[model samples]
Target: MSRPLKERKLLVVAVVSHAIVHICELSFPALQIMVAAEILHNPAAYQKLGFAYFVATLVFGAMALPAGFLVDRIGQRRVLILFLFGAAASMILVGTAQSYLMLVLSLGLMGGFIGLYHPAGASLLSLATRKQGAAMGIHGVGGNFGLAISPLLASGLAAWLGWRLAFAGLGLLPLFCGLWVLVDRSIKVELKAAPEDTDNLDRPDPKLFLLPLLVLFLMATLNGMCYRGFSAFLPAFFKLKIPAGTIPLVSGLVQAGSFTTLVLIAGMVSQFLGGKLADRFVKEKVFTAIFLLCAPFLFLLSRLEGIALLLSATAFAFLYFANQPVSNALLPNYVPRLMRGRLYGWFFFANFGAGSVMSWIAGTVAEKFSLAIIFEILAAIAALTGILGFLLVRVSRPDKKPEV
Candidate 1:
């Protein structure tokens, strides 16, 4: 049967919104260190830049529950519009800042605004698609593209027009997008989910959801650790693996190449198909199992040298991000609407809060335990997470539904 045009259009808007918002947000990261260097006048500006971003993300994660409430109360449209304009203003603030504190404050505000995006967007996307799992994958890919292209585009534009100009000009993106969505007919938030008591999987029995939430929380923590370690170190790793002369371009290209193409595609496929496969196969842990299979692939990639490093890095990037789509895909299915934002907030808190610590942890681990140990830790964590994810899937099974 042919899918209706509206479904395609809704997904396309979701993708476009995801792409633009992320692209605009990420574009600043590459320039952050440079901006800090110029204004802060410190050689350690790079690390501080990372810290600023990390703190902002932590704040964003912290506020997810409230953001979700705002979304539900105000409706996704207005909250989204606020996020868009707020983000743009923050970017402009970032561009015009003359001091370090101002920069930090600007980024902090930007992070807070960006915080409103996922749950609202997730809820919107969830409503738009008949299939949650598939929609999540597509949603995640939009984020991945933002992450992948942000550094590249930001770097290129900043170089051409200066960092300040890049921020000032790119800031206009969300402003324009915000105004458009304010009146866009396509986004019809037709149904507000009725509050229902449920556990982590959003099924009935509020108490039981704790165990699954715990497992998923741990899973999120592990994912955060892997994410922080990899994002923080990949460029350094690439520099070590590749020739010093080629370090600049190769570092960015290696990460971008794999995810820009493969991860996004894999995300949509895994979510949509994983859900259907789970439904048909009646395999409760179907989506979770796919993430489990990705672990060895990530660990194996970290062990290579030279060209092997490049190929392996690419493989791992795709594999690691492949999990993002699946994680959220599992949420709405098991998590009831009322708890969706709260649990999702918990998910981000675990991920980002743990991620906040990972930077310091990795540095310490490298100083004492060795960087290689970090990957080993991630491998073990991913394996454990896969098991928990599978179990969580089982725990979330609806009562009347068949359980495998």
Candidate 2:
């Protein structure tokens, strides 16, 4: 093959591999409701399962900093391989768990492995291409593809073969992919941070990033909390809200899975559209608009039921996911290239770490009060994120002009 063609092919492999990582990352949430029903055997046990999920997600976010540092020391390719192998192993452990403690332990391990993906993958993509926004959007679309399909795939597997086998079956994809990565000599990509730019020698300020980092942190935290809380319980929410006999064609599991799929399908489209918008317009403005639009849909989610609930949830998911690529694309513009991994590390620390807390809180609230209340709170969080997005625009300026 030609050189450019070969390179493009390798990039596609990287992108698709990233997608598979996301599939594994999200498979738990997709299967959590059924797993709770089957294993815990109590309706209230979902809250406990939520806590377990939080532990895993907390580890996922907490480990990102170390993972980022490792990416800087080792090449992104090696880290990707580690993530694939470790994630596959974690999934198998989860599938074979015989008790709650084992399940949580396995999930926490899975989270740790999944944590390696974003910081390392994002840094690699940025280094691979100059059109950072477009690249991020494409990358985001890959993740959304995983997120979109995981629920449906997991649900179908759970129905056909049981949840344990569902995980075991899904685990094979990453196992094969990791082996391919281990042996693929044609795939030659390595990324490291560039040395600090010396052009600003006279203007050196060690604290230059403090304010921008703070804004980004708050923005990521709020957005993460909203996203994680809403998504973590969506299947259960649909299961509870959608009346019996509403759709006679399929089982309840299938209906809930279909609604989840619909929401993620909207998210997939939004990721692509958001990528284009991020590449074209001011990313901060795009983020602000998307978050602002999200609040109403979230509110509608709390109040609506049946088809209205489905539509509003889809709208909410679209806006929630649309923010991802824009926020990711915007981050590198503010930090040094060499520090991108660490920056993403801290960024996702807020994103998933804070989000983990929100998941637990949502579960507690659902146990104490009602699931509908969580959406109301999420709406408020979305509004706060919109305000922060505007603040981010005011306090932070990009280091370079837009690529396209």
Candidate 3:
């Protein structure tokens, strides 16, 4: 039977909400250049700001387990609403900050709220749809679009108005979205038990789960490190590479932001395509191929300059983000529906929490060695992730049913 209209509406709203969260979450990276110039005022001071960003990211990662636990106790809808409202308020607070300490505090608060999005949002989407790969792909498109637009929007607003107004304005989106979700009675929020409530469901075989879980965690951590490290410095890297006279239509700031936006746009297409591929093929195989392909692009990014640099970065981003939906889809195959929230939380803890540390490392490397080295390291990480993906393919048997 066809899905109900209400179910489709829930998917749209959930996707849109996920997009808003990404916009808020990614705004800082896009605005970092302007923030460095206007607020910090020292080239080296960006590393200090990077430290602050790291702290916020650490919180974003650290809170996932707790957020998952809360989702299990309360419900996905309630947790999602809290994430939207709380994240919006935190963005507004970030805009109003005047000092470095205030900015750090505001960002940390925003990270905490942003932390609630992945586990709850992913769980909600998983429960709402059976086409896990396609659903994750559609959901990922929302997030990728947000990632694509945030830089452009932040830069334009910063150029026309100011960075503060940019942050404050973006805050309104999630706030309004949260209110809409609150009153929408059609979206289901209660948790349901597994279909098979047998003893085997209650106590799953450790051998079936343990090895695959470790592989997933390792791959997630590596992917997170590469993603966070590369993104944290992409704006700065482009700013240094792009000549001041290349784009006269706007200021250098806007040009840099535009480049970042262009690179991320490739992710939108790749996410959708990757999701479709996951459904048609073995998800582990698709995941492994994407990671393997990404390494060469990272190496190319390290060597290229100007237009070549932009093209290479775009290719790299396409491969890097394509894995998102594949991994999200693969999770349900191994995990039971009822425990998905907490499992997703743990996965994100590796992805975001451990991965967030890359920002600090990238910053340090940029300060001491060179930004190019960071990409080289990322290339190695991507290759390693591919190896882990292959291992996952061997360990995760397709014939097994999900255990509670």
Candidate 4:
């Protein structure tokens, strides 16, 4: 293949893989209400469902570091193939699960599998493509698109064929994706060598980067909590808060799924704008503003209902997803090229691993207080994330490498 065609092909595969990973990530949240009705059958069904989500997401984020190590040894193509096949099997198990425990374990298994995708796919794009920013931006857009589509797709399928088939149908996406990746001749060639092979002799001492990394990771934890808690519960919140007939339902799945789908679509549009801003501005400053802006909108979401609530959610989604690019750019400025793959693993763990616990926390809050209270807590968390960004600014010297 010509270089342009080769890069395009790799981008296509990476985008699809990125989307599939996120689809798996949010699948539980989208189907939570329906799943609860069948499984828990309790008044606090939404609260009960959070444990399952917590398990799934905890495994998903925690496994990224090991997956990163594995990918370096075997190759991105191989690891991604494993991710797809494993995810397919685990998702199929989720469809066939017989009890709540079975369901939680299946989701956790699926998370463990899909967790491998980021390290494999992200490094592939950075290695194979010349325009790293554009490739990463496009990849991030694919993930946002997946987040947008998951509720509609999961709910629609569940409504048509039942929840079992809904999950089973989702399994088919990764199955086909894995098969394509397996057979595609271009992937094996383009994935390239791991970053350690091209390490710079003048790499900065790891010690000097420590404080900034700590600040960034702390910010990541708060951001992750805010992101996961808000996204996971908003559908449930909408289901409870929105007036009937405000939005159409996907069969019996509830109108909240449709509203959630529309709200996340705003994130898809914001991805482009975020990429542009990340390129133009100081990343930490942009990061600060994004999180700070999210707080007010989250508070708006806490107070509003019906059309006003949807508008608030859309605003929050726009600001929230824009942080992806800015945040992704942050560690690269602080870490060496060879160190990036490993550090990025821990970065995601901070974001997802520690952040996964928020589901349970938010769930408990929703049970004890109200769904609106969850967003108010998230508003506070977003403010904290913004404050951490300011700390990062004081600690980081992105323009100058530390002298050995």
Candidate 5:
């Protein structure tokens, strides 16, 4: 049976708040880089800041595969409650650090903590929602909220208390939420397990699993690259191009606005619409086609200036994030359930791992070139992902069960 309205609402609140913590954290990198440059008395000090994310993901990628398997085995609620604190702490440590080594170590530690969130969170959300796109939509929206708000909150707080405070503040959010989830464990959630075909459990089909994994990896790589460019460069871009404090506030607010709106629209609301359409329509092709089309809007938005740029950015983010719920919602249905967590973990790992590389490359580009070139290159990558996403249906197929 589906959860009661009140119960579902509570869960959404928790997940959404969980997402806000990430948003708060993600925004810290650029500001920290800037601050490190100013105080460390060296532009190169910022390299360690980005290195923190790279090193953390390297450690994290090693763990994520196992993490997913463990989620299914141990239960999502327990892991999230236990490990999210590490993530929260990484932020605090990063915030408090007085030296480059401290900053690097703290950031790496932070990535280690972040590594634990998705497997636990995504699996739990999938388990909670059954096969409902609406539920995932709401959950996706929560993540987007985190992504959106992080920049604004970090930049604003960084302006006052220093960027470290943003990290410290965000680091603590998960702890409180983890506590709440712990207290609420007495309540139970029931979901229909993905039906098993025992005969094929070990060796039913190799191709089915490989395809979705491959496609998702590719998509994530492109999107991750694009995301790094946008999130890392946009504020600085805005600051250089726009008026005083305009970049921080406007970039943050616009991002926040786009995130919340897309979640409500594409993530939550449009998700149900996509689901209904998928029931009768040619779902894969249609969805992929729609995704491919987002590039034009993004390209158009990338070229503008001032308020026009902000408005364009809002529209661009909306369209970009809009694809998330639809794409993620499609995965469970295609995969065999038992493999879902593994697949999701690998999916995120591939995305983030590749993305980390992209971010490093982007930073290199920024060092050598300019932020404008970086965004332009990312825009091109987005277009490439869109094209690849559409072709995915022809190249790959989902599994029969949706367990993991």
Candidate 6:
């Protein structure tokens, strides 16, 4: 097969895998209420279900590094195939779950399986494509689609079938993708040593790489805080600032749920553009500028009300998701080809693990102070991310790209 054909095939598999990762990630929340209502027979069981998902998410974040280790040993293709079959089985278990404990265990299994994607899939994208930023962006769009569709798809499936079938039905996508990959000989997943590793120019200096790697890790943690923290409370913040009766028909039409959907759709566009820009420009500078710009919109989001608040939020969401592709592309510059997967594991752990903490903090702050304060806090975090980005720009050599 031609190289370009192979790349395209690999991209398709990566994108589909990325989408299923998120579908599995978010589908539980969509179905949790139904699970509480139907199986537990208590609406108040929502909190318990939420806690179960929380533990499951911890499992998700915790598995990234080990998954990376597995990828480094065997190969991303094999690990991703495992993720597919494992996630499929877990989701099917969720469907068959007859008791509350059974449901929680199934969710944890689902988390563990889906958690394998980022390290494996992301490394595969970096290895397969020269346009790292564009590939990551396109891959991110798959995730955005998954996020956008999960609530509606899962809920609709439940409404039409039942919560059990909803989850089981969702599993069919990965199972199908897994089967396609298994039968298709064109998709390459084996790791080959890069020829460029023999060149000294391609290798980064260990001494100088440390500080920037640390900064990148810190910036990733903060970015995670901004992403998860903002998302966790955005609907509440919108409802609070722009109350149900605030904008007349607008209020009823674009309430919290619909507004979030709009933000996610906007994310799809911004992510693609962000990827293109990252490919065109100095990625670190582009990333830094995006994060810096986020602070102002976030600040505006905090202080404004009515339509102005909505516009600021839209701007913030645009800038927030735009950084994803740029940041994903940045790591290759600092890490050697062989270790990229492990670094990605650490990077996502910082992003998702540390990020999970911000939800609780934002909640407490909202209870003690106000929802608007959450934006202000996020604005500060964005500013810090920008500062780290600036430092990263100084350290990163943009003239060269990693070879795998």
The deviation in Å at residue 143 for candidate 2 is: 0.8
Give the runs in model 5 whose Cα sits over 4 Å from its true position.
Answer: 5-10, 42-49, 56-63, 187-209, 245-283, 396-404
Question: What's the distance in Å from true for residue 179, model 2?
Answer: 1.5
TM-score of 3: 0.94
Structural RMSD, model 5: 4.7
Highest-TM-score candidate: 3
Residue pairs clashing in model 1 are 134-272, 200-209, 201-334, 201-335, 202-334, 202-335, 202-336
The CA lDDT of each predicted structure is 0.62, 0.80, 0.82, 0.80, 0.59, 0.76
TM-score of each: 0.79, 0.93, 0.94, 0.93, 0.82, 0.84
Cα displacement (angstroms), candidate 6, residue 213, comes to: 1.2
Ranking by lDDT: 3, 4, 2, 6, 1, 5
lDDT value for model 2: 0.80
Where in model 2 is the C-alpha error above 4 Å? 1-7, 186-208, 398-403
Best by lDDT: 3
Residue pairs with colliding backbones in model 3 are: none
- Rank by TM-score, descending? 3, 2, 4, 6, 5, 1
* lDDT of each residue in 1-404, candidate 6, tens digit only: 76677778888888888888877776765665567777789743534654566556667777888988887888887888889989898998989988888877888888888888889988888777767888889988888777666655766677778888989999998899888877776666545622233213355566456766788888888987787667656655665566686545543323554555566667777888888887777777888999888899998899997678888888887877888888888777677788878988988888876765666576567656777888899999999899888888887555344322
lDDT of 4 by residue, 1-404 (tens): 67778788888898898889888788888887777777777635766788888888899889889877776677778888999999999988998888899988999999899888877776676567654545667778898889988888887788788888889889999999999999985685333332233223256666446787898889888888998898789878887888767655334345777888899999987876776676666777888888988889998899998889999999999988888866775566665555555777788888888999999889888888888999999999998898788888887665322222
For 26-46, candidate 2 gives per-residue lDDT tens digits of 677777876777678775565
Output the better candidate (2/6) by lDDT.
Answer: 2
Q: Which stretches of candidate 6 lie over 4 Å from their true place?
A: 31-50, 95-103, 190-204, 233-258, 299-310, 360-376, 397-404
Q: Write the per-residue lDDT of candidate 3 for residues 1-404, one digit (tens) a residue.
A: 23556457767887898788778877887777667666788655657767878988888988888988887788888888899899889999999888788989999999899898898888877777656678789889988998888888888887887889999999999999988989986665344422232213334577566778889889999998988888778877888787765778788778888999999999999989888887788787888999999899998898878999999999999888999998887776667777889999999999999999988888888888888888998899999999888889899755332221
